[model samples]
Target: MTAPSGTTPNPLEALRAKLAAEPAVVDAAAPVVDAATLEDDYIVCHCTNVTAGELRGLIHEAGCSSLEEIQRCTRAGGSCGKCVPLLTEVVSIELGRAGIA
Candidate 1:
C-alpha cells in the first residue's frame, strides 16, 4: 500500500477504516424501517439519543439537506459514527418526504 504515502494517517480516512471494519455497526440483512412510519420517539442514533423526528425537523424546518449539516446541528453520528449510514438513510427519506432536493 506504500504506507499511504504520508507521514501521518488522515483522520477522516482513519475514521472510514474504523467504520468499515465495524461489523456490529450495521447488518446487511437487517430490515430498514420506513421513515414515514417512525414516531417522534423513534431513535435513529442511540449513542447521541437523536430521534427520527428531530432529523425530520432538521430537514423540513431547518432545511438541512446533507449529513454534514445534520451532524453539525445535532451531533447524531459524532460519537461512534456507526449510525452514520442509517442516519444518512433516514435523512434521505426525510428529504424525499419533504420534497427537498
Candidate 2:
C-alpha cells in the first residue's frame, strides 16, 4: 500500500525528517555540553553492551533524535527491550545537554 501524501514511508523516517527540519533553538545563555566531552561510562543496555557514551555518539554524530532510531542504529534496546526506559532517559538527557531542544 502506498503511504499517504506528505507522509514519510515509515514512522521512523518521518521522525528523523521532522527532527532534521526543526530549528535548534539553543539558549545562548545556557551552557552547551559537547557530546564528545560527555563522560558516559555507565552501560544502559547490558543485553547489547550499549554504553551511554555509545548512545550519545549515535545522537550527536549519527543524528538520532529518538529512542527508536538509537535502537535501530546501536541495537541498544533491541534485545529484551527492558532497557527502553533508561535508554529514553539517556536520550533526553543527552539531547538536552547537547542543546538540541
Candidate 3:
C-alpha cells in the first residue's frame, strides 16, 4: 500500500494504533505467574486431569523433554487446547529444574 500523497506512514505508529485499539490486551508491567511456584498437585491441564507432579515424573523419571512427548504419554493438551500454555509452562519449569530447559 502506498502512503497518502507525499506523507510517509510510520510502521511503528500503525502498530501502536492497532495495539491501542485492542483494550486491555497486554500489561507490560504485569508479572507472569511462575509455574515452578505452583504445588505438584496443581492441575496444569484441566482437560486431561494432568497435574504438575505427573509432568515432573515424565520429565525426571521418564526423561520426557518436549510437550509433544508429554502429550503422547498423557494426552494432556489433546482436547480444546486451552490448557496447552499452562502445560508448556509446567513443562518448562520441570525441565528448567532438571537442568534441561
Candidate 4:
C-alpha cells in the first residue's frame, strides 16, 4: 500500500517494529490505576448532594476558580462546610486538568 504523498509513515508502527526487535522488559513496580474504576458519580457534598462529576463540570464548564465560587454555583460547601476541603481539592484537580491554573 502506498503512503500518502509527502507524508511520513505512522510513528506508532515504527515504535512497534523497534519494540519487536528488542528484549522484553518488565517493571513490576510500575503504578497501575484503572481509570474506569475511578469513582466520578459519588456524592462530594451530602448537603447539596453534589457529585464529583458535577463539581468537575462546574470547574471546567462554568469556569469556577475557587471553593467559594463553586459553593455559589453548586452549593457544595455552603452547609456545615465539612466538605470545603474536598471541594477545594476537586476544583484544583479540575482546573489543573483543564490547564487553567
Q: Per-residue alpha-carbon lDDT of model 1 for 1-101, expressed as tens digits?
A: 12356577677877777777874665753437765678888998999899988998889888888878899989998998777777888887787887875
Q: Candidate 4's residue-wise lDDT over 13-56, tens digit each?
A: 87888888896987533323332233778677889999888877
Q: lDDT values of the candidates?
A: 0.80, 0.74, 0.82, 0.72
How well is each residue in 10-100 modelled by candidate 2, as lDDT tens digits? 8777777788888678654333443335467867788998888888888888788777777888888788876776777778888887777
lDDT of 3 by residue, 1-101 (tens): 34698899889888788778875766533335677787889887778899888999999999998888999999998997777777887888788889987
Instruction: Assess every candidate by TM-score.
Output: 0.63, 0.55, 0.65, 0.57
The true-versus-predicted C-alpha distance at residue 30 of model 2, in Å, is 28
Clashes of each: 0, 0, 0, 0
Q: Residue 3 error for model 4, in Å?
A: 92
| Comparison by lDDT, 1 against 3, better one | 3
How far residue 91's Cα lies from its native spot in candidate 3, in Å, is 0.6
Whole-structure CA lDDT of model 4: 0.72
Error of 2 at 20 (Å): 53
Please report the TM-score between candidate 2 and the true structure. Answer: 0.55
Candidate 1: C-alpha lDDT: 0.80
